[model samples]
Every structure is written in C-alpha cells, then in structure tokens.
Target: MNEHVPDPAAKLEERAKRKAAKREVKKTEIAASTLDALKQLGYANTTLRDIAAQSGMSLGSLTYYFTDKVELITYCVRLYKAEFIDRIEKSVTSAEGRDAVIDAFADELTRSMTEDLPTHRLWYDIRSQAMFDPAFRPVVEEIEGKLLETLTRVVQAAGQQDTSAVPLGYAMIDGVFRFLLQSRDRHARDNDELMAIFTAILRRIF
Candidate 1:
C-alpha cells in the first residue's frame, strides 16, 4: 500500500492563493500607516523607517512588501485616482443627458478630492514630490494618465473629441487646485462652487 500524498500542483496553488491574500492584507496595512506618516511628516520628510514604525513592522518587512518609496507612493496614488475616477464616472453615467452628466461629473470630482482638507494636502504633497524626483515621475505620469483617461472618456461620451480639451480640462482643475491649496486655504464648502465652474467649462468645450 502506498502512502497518500497531496497533489503538488494543488499544494502550489493553495500556497499562491495564501501568498496573494497575505500581500493584500500587508498592502492595506502599509497604505494606512504610510498615509498617516505622510500626514505627520509630509511627503519629502517621510521615510520608510517612519512608515514601518507606524505600522509596527520592520523596515525589512516593508521592503519585502513594497519595492521602494515609488511603489508605495504609487499605491497611494492609485487609491486616490480610483476614488476620484469612480465618483466622476458614476455621476456622469447616472445622469439624464450630456449637460447634466458633465455637470454632475464635475461636482462629484470636486466633492471627492477637496471635501476633505487632508485629501487636498496629501495630493499637494504627492504632486509636488513628483515634480522634482526622477523616481516619482513615472508614478505621477501613470496617475495623470489614469486621470486624463477618465476625463477623456467622459468628454467623448458627451459627444465631442477635441483632443485639446483633455489638457484644457486639466488646466481648469489645476488652476482651481493651485488656488485652493496655495493662493488660499480651501474649505469644504468651496467644493460645490468649484464643481459648478468646472462643469461650466466642460459644457462649453464639449
């Protein structure tokens, strides 16, 4: 009689699944703690050691979990970009017509990104850091690509294909973003007004 043995392929698949689940958990923990560190230390000052300490993990552990600072920042960017895009897409898709859809999309986007002061601060940190560092440029570009992709799709769906409108739309928000964070401290209430004006621009272009 031969001893029973587990199938090797099944064993490997189970191991892989477990590894993936563990990675997901670690990613969540890292994200939460890293964001907290970002708040406390700001973008340029925050280090991997700080994040590891906050998360109650060793630097080696964080290294195993993330390739580098760029990877971690990219994760944060992905989270924000996804939230922004999801809200805008939902509002636009659910609206009755082109005008309403564009307006609602703008409103939702502004509402999501600036309704919280911390969110605006975090964005300011990431965008500023990306501008000076070679390591972060790709991450910023990737985030920007995702952002513009969402806007472009929405604009096209609304019945226009002005390639220039993509950057123009971006400029409108960038101007508002700069004004909010730099020219003056932004309040939550300003979100509604910003959204209205942005939508007005999109409506004109589209």
Candidate 2:
C-alpha cells in the first residue's frame, strides 16, 4: 500500500509560513543591529551599510527587509518601546509596597544611567530628532504616553493618592538625568546618594 501524500496546497501554505517566519527573524536581527549601530555611531552618522555589516546581512538583503533607514529606525523604536513597557510592568508587579516601588524606580534609573546608557542615549537622540522630524513624532508621542501611563500605574500601586505625581516624578527624574549628562563636575555619585535623591523626589511627589 502507498503512504498518503501531503496535499500540494497545504505544502505551499507551510512554505509560505516558513518564509514569513524567516523574514520576521531577519527583520528583528536587522533592527537589533541598527540599534547597536545607532548607539555607537549616533543617528546622523549611522548608515545602512553599518547596520547590514553588524547584522551580517548584505546591503541588498537588508534593503529587501527594510526599504530604508527611516523605516528600519521606526521599526526599531517600536520594538524598543514594546520591550521597555513590558519590563516596567514586570518590575513594578513583582515588587510589593511603596518602599519596594521606590526601590524598583531607583533600580531602573540606575540601570538606565549606567548599564543601559547606550539605549537611553539612543532614546534621547531620537527624542531630540523627533522635535524636527515628522517621521519620528508619532512613535515618540506614543512611547511617551505609554511610559507616562506605566509610571502612573506604578505610583498608584505604591499608595500614592495624588494623580499628578507621575508627571512631577518624571520631571524630577528628567532633571536629574539632564544634570548628570550636562554637568562636568557631576561625577562619582554613589548609589546611596542617588537613591536618597530619588526617595526624596518620591516623597515630594506622593
């Protein structure tokens, strides 16, 4: 007896799915490389060739996946925001109490300032560019709104009665970030000092 053969139409569909999966994987790989390239080279200096080289894909292959640098950057920004929001939610949910909320906030800030500096710098680079570039505005607006919403949720969970605390909290944090980035004399602040300042801001806001 002959074994049953798979249907041709079903096989075609499976092949299409595999192709789509591979394309998606390639897209993500390209985006990841683009992010690293952007971090190392800055937005203006980063090129498609750099991204392609970093991704281990040829320029033609990268272009086939992403039409141009703008498209690739937009895709990377969206991916970054999605992952960032997920992380914030997970971190906030895992910790308990207001003190824990403060701890979580400080921990995230520390990581952003130190371990995640490149990503944060890339974020600001995009943010500054978004002010003048129409292509980046939508994503920047969406990311800012989503981030504020996450902060608001965390504040509420931390027993903060004030609804406006999120904005104030972020403003204070942003001020600190700017200070650290701009000030030449602002070097070598210990974790204790940083956490103290963060806790003080939380107290004022809450």
> How many pairs collide in each candidate, listed in order?
0, 0
Candidate 2 structure quality by residue, lDDT tens digits, 34-141: 888898899889889999998888999889999998889889988887887787677778888898887887666655566556676777888899989998899888
- The ten-residue window of minimal lDDT in model 1 covers 180-189
Q: What is the TM-score of each candidate against the true structure?
A: 0.82, 0.83
The lDDT per prediction is 0.76, 0.79
List all candidate RMSDs to the true structure: 3.1, 3.1
- Model 2 misplacement above 4 A: 1-18, 182-186
Could you tell me how far off, in angstroms, the CA of residue 35 lies in candidate 1 after the best superposition?
1.1
Candidate 1: list runs displaced more than 4 Å: 1-6, 161-164, 184-191
lDDT of 1 by residue, 110-183 (tens): 66556545655877677787778777778778777887888787877776767676878777776776665564
Model 2, TM vs. native: 0.83
